[model samples]
Target: MEDSVFSLIRTKYNTLSPTQKNVADYILSNSEKVILLSIGELAQFCDTSETTVIRFLRKLKYDSYQVFRVKIAQELSGETTDSIYEEIGTDDDIADIKRKVIQLTISSINDLNNLLDEKQLAFFTEAIVSGGKAIFIGVGSSGIIAADAYHKFLRLGIDASFSSDSHIMSIACAHARKQDLVVAFSHSGESRDILESVELAKEGGAKIAAITSYPNSSLSKSSDIVLLSSSRETKYRSDAMISRIIQLVIIDTLYVSTVLKLGSEGIKRLHKSRLAVAKKKT
Candidate 1:
């Protein structure tokens, strides 16, 4: 089998340029050898320039071409679909656990590209771009993703902050208004504290957006928009593991979308923010 690397690219075929399309065509058909191809080798094989290969990778949202190759190799290892998430039994071996986590996280992210809705993504992004103040709420694992997201928005000069503590989120909701945005991050979508704060913000007329697994859960029901993600099932539900990785992927997607909407101004703000802190790096 060629693995999903072929189907994934073909799904986005029309969007690729002439050069990138050629590269995609070659890769999709030759996915087996793609694992061993470097960026230059790939470009040569496709009769395109290295720059074209990189641009193709950028369109796929990969940080670097190397990571893209690694993902392809992982996919070919035969664990993308079933058996991606293995049960952590009482006597699970270290090697098996490592492979399970690696395959599961990759599979989770790949599934997100399909699970997320384009219209909903655009609607919330439009809201954020239209001067909507945002407050992100999450606890424990979700909290870390929210915090990182908060930092990204802060650097881009967006009016947003992350609140993990129940008390702080409640306080923030008290002051929230109709035009503000309340983002609830929960994998299970059943957090009592998150639901309570979401309800409070909803009463204040804030535009609520939720990033959670269950679309019919309280957090989802209370929110004006829900950005759904597929949470992998495991023996025990824990933090800083598989689901957190999916949450972060969602966060990065939103951050990139926001940056694209903000355009040049967002880039300048990010550069300036980095500069302000760069002096402290000594």
Candidate 2:
């Protein structure tokens, strides 16, 4: 597969230096013009030195400015000019805030096309479908995503469990078997409790899958499979908040794929689950 320049930028954005970030910001905001600009011109436009621009390219793992431009040009060849994210200001009206929020949400979700690795996603789906048992763990807002995944899996009649409590998570991990799959959700992927729980799961001989934003995070390091989520933070909106939505979308994708893989049996389980719930309605 070809490299995605924008996805690479977002993946490494948090780790870039201040000057490198400046170059990144300019390239992200003016991608069209960036591909057409010379290295010296881009440095001047970003108010940084040519050395800084070269350093930024290196961070993205491009050997030369020409290669970097070629990748960006390839990515932009079939793309439309859409605002990826916008900062919400105190002076903005409710309508302005609503528009910005929707745009940001759509753009972030679209970025998943580039951010997600299809092979990793297939690994996760197959793990939960055939691994026999699955445990979902997360904290704070990520806990919500874990719980949602647990619910979806349960409706599919998969033996799944979830807990937001660190103590219960630890206990669950301790009991994880080789056939068990442990799915951990953490946007930053650095949550101490999550890392500890994953470590325990690893020791117990379970397959670890991490859904997170940072590829270099500790949790990703320990996992057998990692699914990356794309998000950008602003004054009013944090990466965690934005990543929550993206995480849910990933969960939905997994759920649907699991159902298709399970065939008729999966549909029956879903139908039965819905019927059981409908019996409780007044």
Cα lDDT of candidate 2 equals 0.87
What is the C-alpha lDDT profile of model 2 across 1-282, one tens digit per residue? 654577667657767889998898888778889889999999999999999998898888887999888877877776743324357899999999999888878777877887788999899988998856899999999998999999999999999999999999999999999989999999999999999999998898999999999888898889999998887867798888778999999999889989999999999999999998997999
TM-score of every prediction relative to native? 0.69, 0.87
Best by lDDT: 2
With a 3 Å backbone cut-off (N, CA, C), the pairs that clash in candidate 2 are: none
List runs of model 1 lying over 4 Å from the truth.
1-85, 236-240
Q: RMSD in Å for candidate 2, one decimal?
A: 3.0
Error of 1 at 151 (Å): 0.6
lDDT of each: 0.77, 0.87
